[model samples]
Target chain A: MAILLDGKKTASELNETTRKRILKLKQCGIVPGLAVVIVGEDQASQRYVRNKHKLALKLGMNSVIKEVPASITEAQLLALITELNQDTTIQAILVQDPLPKHINEQRIMQSISSTKDVDGFTAVNVGQLYLNLTGNYPVACTPKGIMTLLEKYDIFLRGKKAVVIGRSAIVGKPMAALLVNAGASVSILHRYTTEIAEYTRDADLIISATGVLRLLGAEAVKPGAVIVDVGQNLDETGHLVGDVDFNAVKDKVAAITPVPGGVGPMTIATLMQQTVDLTEWGLANGK
Target chain B: MAILLDGKKTASELNETTRKRILKLKQCGIVPGLAVVIVGEDQASQRYVRNKHKLALKLGMNSVIKEVPASITEAQLLALITELNQDTTIQAILVQDPLPKHINEQRIMQSISSTKDVDGFTAVNVGQLYLNLTGNYPVACTPKGIMTLLEKYDIFLRGKKAVVIGRSAIVGKPMAALLVNAGASVSILHRYTTEIAEYTRDADLIISATGVLRLLGAEAVKPGAVIVDVGQNLDETGHLVGDVDFNAVKDKVAAITPVPGGVGPMTIATLMQQTVDLTEWGLANGK
Candidate 1:
C-alpha cells in the first residue's frame, strides 16, 4: 500500500514556521497584513475566508475581510481593489473566486497592483513565473502549496518523468513550471491528450487536478510512483473525492495524498504563507 | 522525403510585413529603434551583429551598434546596458551572446528592462512566455520566428504531438512553450532522456536544437512528420550542419528545414521585426 502524504501534518508544520516569522517581523515594528475581498455570500467562500481570518490572527498577522453584497457593481469592486492596491497598510490583496456573474473577474484581477498581488494571479507575476525569471513574486497559492508539500516529503523531482493531468491556469500550468524548475521532464495532458495512459504509466510522479473522481486507475500508475491528488470532486453521496482511484492504486504507489486531508490543508497553508510573505515584502519595500 | 521548411523566404516575407508596419508608424512620426551591444569580436557574434544591423536599416528602424572590448569588466557592460534601458528612443535591446566567461550572463540580462528585452532572455519574460500570458512586450524573437514559420505553412498545431529534442534556455525551452500555446502536447527531451527515439518517432512535429550533427536519422522520425532543425553545428571541414541526418530523413518527412537556410535567417528576421515593434510600441506608449 502507498504511504499517505499527510498534508494535515505538513500544513500544521508550515503554520508553525509562519507563526515564528510573523512574530519576528512584529518585533521589528512590522505587522503582516492581508486584505480579502469577497463579493456575494458564497457559503464555501465565506467558510474559507473565516478560516483564513482565524488562521491569520492566530499566526499574529492582521486579517481584514471586505464583504460586498451580490448587488455590488464591477466598478465598485474595481474601486475596492484599487483602494486596497494603494493602501500601504495592506501588504497583500486577495479577491475571492467566483465573483457575481455581472462582475468581470479578470478585469478585477488586472486592477490589483503586481507588488500587492499576493494571490499571484496577476499577469505580471504569472508571466514572471512562466519565464523562470528572477522576480517570480508569489506564485498561485495552490500550485505553490503543492510544491511545498513535495519538498517537505523529500520527493526527488530532478530528471524524473512527471505527468500533470489537466491544464488549468491555476494548478496544472504552475505545477508544470515548478516541476520543470526541479529539472523534471514534464508533460501536460489536457482534454486533447489521447495517450495519457502511456505517459502516466511511465511517470515517476503524477499530479492529478482534473477535479474528477476516479479519473486515474491503478493501471495508469507505475509501482512505487509518487502520486499527488489535487482533485476535489463530489461523489454520488455529495462527499468529496480526488482524481485518483485511491483504493485501486494504493498498493501500487509508493506515496499518495488522500483527498480530504491531503492537498486541501496545504492550499490554505500556502495562502497564509503568501500573506505573511507579502506583508514582510511590503514593510521592506513600502509597497 | 521531408519537405524543407524554407526559413529564408519565409523570413523575407515577414520582413516585408514588418517594413510596412514601420513605414506606417513612421508616417505617424514614429521610428522603431534598436540598440545592439556586441561584446568581443567573435566571428559568429560579429556576423550576427552585422546581419541585425543590415536588417534594422532595411526595416526603416534606427539601429545603434555599441561594440565593447572583450576584456571589458561586467560593470562596464552593465553601464552600457543601463543607458540603453533608460533611453526612451531605444525600444529594443539585443546583447550579443557568448559574453566573456568572467561576466555573469543572468545579471547582465536582468539589467535590460522588460520593455526593451527584445531578446526575451530575462527571467520575467521567460516566465510569462511559459505561462502563455501575452503581455504588452516582445517575446523571445527566435521562438516567435519559428511559430510564425509554422503558421505560414498552414500547419495546425492544435492536438498535435510535438517532440522538442533539446532543452536550451534560448531555443528549446521557449519553443516548447510556444508549441504548448498552440494547443500541442509537447514532450521536451534532453541528454538525460531515456529512449528519446520512441517519442521522436511518434511526434507529429519534431524540432531538434541539440547541435549534435545527425542525431535524428530516417528511422528516428515518423513518416510525414514536420521536422525543424535549429542546430547549427559545424563539421570538422567547417561545413554548417544540423542535428538530423538530412539525406536519410529527407525522403520520409513531409517538411523539414535546411541547415543554413532554415532557422538561422528566421532568428534575425524576428529580431528585426521586434526592433520595429519596440519602436512602434514606444511611440504609442513611451509617454
Candidate 2:
C-alpha cells in the first residue's frame, strides 16, 4: 500500500504552531482579527464560515461574520468593504464567494485592501504571485496549504514533471504557478485539453482539482507518482469523494492523500495561519 | 514545404490599422502620446528607443524620450515617473529595462500608473492578464504581439498542445498564461528543465523565447509542428538568428517565424497599438 499523506495530522501540527504564534502576538497586545463578509444565506458558505470562526476563537484570535441580505446593492457592498478596509482592528478581510448576482464580484474583490485580502483573490496579490515578487503577501489558501504539505513531506520539485488537471483561478492556476516557481516543468489541463492521460501518465506529480468524481484513475497515473486530489464530490452512494479513485490507485502510487482527510482540512488550517500572518504584517507595516 | 509565417508582413498590416486608429483619435482632438524613459547610455537601449520614437511619429502620435542620468537616485526617478503619471497628454509610459544596479527595478515598475503602463510590467496589469480581465488594460508588448500573430494566421488554439520555453516575466510566463487562457494545454520549460525535447516533440505549437542560439533544432521538433521563435541572438558570422534552426526546420514544420522579422517587429507594432488603445480608453473613462 502507498504511504498516506495524512492531512488531519499535518493540519493539527500546523494549528499548534499557529496557536503559539497567536499567543505571542497576544502578549504583544496585538490580537489577530479576521472578518468574513457573506451576502445571502448559502448553507455551504455558512458552514464554512462557522467552522472558520470556531477555529479562530479556539486559536485565541478575533473572528467576526458580517451577514448582509441578498438585496444589498453593489454600492452598499462596496461601502461595506471600504469600511472594513478602514477598520483598524480587522487585520484580514474575506468576502465569501457566491455573492448576489447583481453585485459585480470582481469589482467587489478589487475593493478589498490588498494587505488585508486574506483570501488572496485581489488582482494585486494574484499579479504578485505570478511575478514571483519577494517579501510578504498572502496567497490563495488552498494552494498555499498544498505547498506546505509538499514541503513537510520533503518532496523536492526541482525539474520534476507536474501536471495540474484544472485551470481555476482559485486552485489550479495558482498551484501551477507555485510549482513552476519552484523549478518544476508545469502543464495545465482543462476542459479543452484532449487526451488528458497523454500528459498525466508521464507526470512525476499529478494534482487534480477538477471536482469530478474518480476523474483520475490508476491507468492515467504512472506508478510511483505522488497524487494530490483537491476535488470534493459526492459519489454514487452519496459518500464524499475526491477526484482520484483513491482505493484503486493507492497500491500503485508511491503516496496519496485521502479525499475527506486530505486537502479539505488543510484549507481551514491555512486560513487561520494566513490570518495571523496578515495581522503580523499589518503590525510591522503600521497599517 | 512549410509555410513562412512572415512577421514583417503581418506587423505591417497591424501598423496600418494602428495608423488609421491614431488618425481617428486625432480627428477627435485626442492625440495618443507615449513617453519612453531611459536611464544611462546603453547603446542597445538608445537604438530601441530611437526606433520606437520614429514609429510613433510615423503613426501620427506624440512621442518623447526622457533621458535621465545613470547616477539618478531611486527617489528622483520615482518623482520623474510621478510627474509623467500626472501629465494629461501622456497616455502610455514605458521605462526601458536595465536601469543602473542601484535602482530597484520592481519598485520602479510599480511606480508607473497602471493606466499608462504601456509595457504592462506593472503589478495591476500583469495581474489583470493572468486573471483574464476584460476591458482596457495594456498587456506586455511581446506576448500581445504573439497573440496577434496567432490570430491573424487563423491558428485556432483550442484543444492544442502548446509549449513555451523560458520563464522571464516579459515573455514566457505571460505567453503561457495567454495560451492557457485561450484553452490550450500549455507547458512552460526553463533552465531547470531536463530534456526539453521530451515535451516539445509532442507539442502542436512551440514558442521559444530563450535567448539561446538555435535552441529548438530539427531533433527537438516534431513533423509539421507550428513554431514561433522569440529569441534574438548574434550568430558567430555576425548575423542575427533566433532560437530555432530556421534552415534546418524550415521544410520539417507546417509554419515558422523568422528571427529579426518575426517577433521583433511585432513588439513595436503592438506598442503603437496599445498607445492608441490607452488614449481611447482614457477618453471613454475621462481619465
Candidate 3:
C-alpha cells in the first residue's frame, strides 16, 4: 500500500508553527486579525466561517464574522469591503464563496485590499502568482497548503510531469501556477478535455479539483504517481469522498492525500498561517 | 504545402476595422490616444516605439512618445507613469521592456493603470485574463493577437490538445491562459521540460514562443497540426525566421504562421486595436 500523505498530521504541525508566530506578534503588541464576510446563511459557509473564527480565537488572534442577508445589494457589499480595506485591525480579509446571485461576486472579491486579501482571490495577487513575481504574496489557501504538504514529503517538482484537472479560480488555476513556477511541466485539464487519462497516466503528480466522484482510478493514473484530491463530494452511500477512488488507486500510487484528512485540514491551517504572515508583512512594510 | 496563417494580411484587415473605430470616436469628438514610453536610447526599443506611434497616427488617433534617459531612477519612472495616468487625453500606455538594471521592471509595468495599460502587462489585467473573467479588459498583445489569428483560420480550440512552449510573462503564459480559457487542454513547456516532443507530437495545436532558433521541424511536430510560431529569430543566413523549421514542416503541417509575416505584424495591429478599445471603454465608463 502507498503511504498516506497525512494532511491532518501535517496541518497540526503547521498550525503549531502558526501559533508560535502569533505569540511573537503578541510580544510586539501586534495581534493578527482576520475578518470573514458571509452574504447569506449558507449552512456550509456558516460552518466554515465558524470554524475559522473559533480557530483564530484559539490561536490567540482577533477574528470577526460579518454575516449579512442574502438580499444585500452589490453596492452595499462593496461599501462593507471598502470599510474592511481601511480597517487597521483587520490584517486579512476573506469573502465567503457562493455569494448571492444578486451580487457581482468577482467585483466584490477583487475589492479587498491586496495586503489583506487572505484568500488571494484578487486579480493582483493571482497575476503575481501567474507571473512568478519575486516577492511575498498570498496564494489560494488550498493550493498553497498542498505545496506545503508536498514539500514535507520531499516530492520533487522540478521538470516533473504534472496534471491539474480543473480550472477554478480558487483552486485549480492557482495550483497549476504554483506547480509551473516550480519548474514542473504542468498541463491544465478541464471539462473540455477529451481524454483526461492521456495526461494523468503520464503524470508524476496529479491534482484533481473537479468535484467529480471517482473521477480517477488505478487505470486512469500512472503507477507511483502522487495524487492530490481537492474534491469534497458525496459518494453513493453519502460518505464524504474526494475526486479519486482511494480504494482502487491507493495501492498503485506512490502517495496520496485522503478525502477528509487531506486538503480540507491543510486549507484552514494555511489560512491561519497566512493570517499571521500578512500581519508580519504589514508590520514590516509599515502598512 | 500547408496554408499560411498570413498575419500580415489579417493584421491589415484588423487595422482597417481599427481605423473605422477611430473614425467613430472622432465623430463623437474623441480622439483615441496612445502613449509609448521608451527609456534610454536603445535603437531597437526606439524603433518599436516609433512603429507604434506611427500606427496610432495612421489610424487617425492621438499618439505620444515619452523618451527618457537610461539614468532615470525607479521613482522618476513611477512619477512619469502617474502623470500619464491622470492625463485624460492618454487612453493607452505602454512602457518599453528591457529596462535598466537599476529599475524594477515589473513594478514599472504594473504601475500603469489597468484602463490605460495598452500592453496589458499590468497584474490586474493579467489576472482578469487568467481568471477568464468577463468584461472588457486588455490582454498581452502577442498572445491575444495569436488568438485572433487562430480564429481567422477557423481553428477549433475546444477539446483540442495544445502545447505552448515557454512561459514568458508577455507571450507563453498568457497564450496558455487564452487557450485554456477557450477550452483547450494546454501544457506549458519550459527549459526544464524533459522531452518537449512527448507533448508536442500529441498536440492538435502548437504555439511556440521560446526564442530558440530551429526549435521544431517536421519530425518534432504532428501531422496536420496547426502551428503558431511566436518566436522571431535569425537563421545562419541572418534572415528573420521563427521557432519552427518552416521550410521543413510547412509541407507536413495543416497550417503555420510564417515568422516575418506571422505573430510580428499581428502584435502591433492588436495593440492599435486595443488602444481604440480602451479609449471607447473609457468613454463609456466616463474614465
Which structure among the candidates has the greatest lDDT? 3
List, residue by residue over B1-287, the lDDT tens digit for candidate 2.
Answer: 77877789999999999999998987888889999999999998999999999999999999989999999999999999999999998999999988999999999998899999998888888888887877678889999999999888888899999999998889999999999999999999999999799999999999999989978889998998999999989999999999999998998999898888998899999999999988888889977
**The TM-score obtained for chain B of candidate 3 when compared with the true chain B:** 0.98
Q: Compose the digit string of candidate 1's lDDT tens values, residues A1-287.
A: 78899999999999999999988988988887889999999998999899988998998898899999999999999989989888877888989888899987777887888887887877667766765666438888888988889899899887788888877667887787777767787887777777778888988999998877788899999999999999988888998889998999999999999988899899889888988877776666755
Model 3: per-residue lDDT, tens digit, B7-124?
Answer: 9999999999999989988998999888888999998788888888888899999999999999999999999999999999999999988899999999999889999998778888
Better of 1 and 2 by TM-score: 2
Summed backbone clashes in each candidate are 16, 0, 0
Per-model TM-score of chain B? 0.95, 0.98, 0.98
Q: Which candidate model has the greater lDDT, 2 or 3?
A: 3
Mark the 10 consecutive residues where model 1 chain A has the least summed lDDT: A127-136
Question: Reference contacts recovered by each candidate, as fractions?
Answer: 0.36, 0.79, 0.80
Colliding residue pairs in candidate 3? none
Give candidate 3's error at residue B198 in angstroms: 0.6
Give the lowest summed-lDDT range of ten residues in model 1 chain B: B127-136
RMSD of 1: 2.3
Docking quality class, candidate 2? high
lDDT of 2 by residue, A1-287 (tens): 98888888899999999999999999999899999999999998999899899999999999989999999999999999999999988999999998888988989988899999997888889889998998899889999999898888888899999999999878988899999899999999999998899998999999999988888888999999999999999999999999999998999999888888889889889999999999988888886
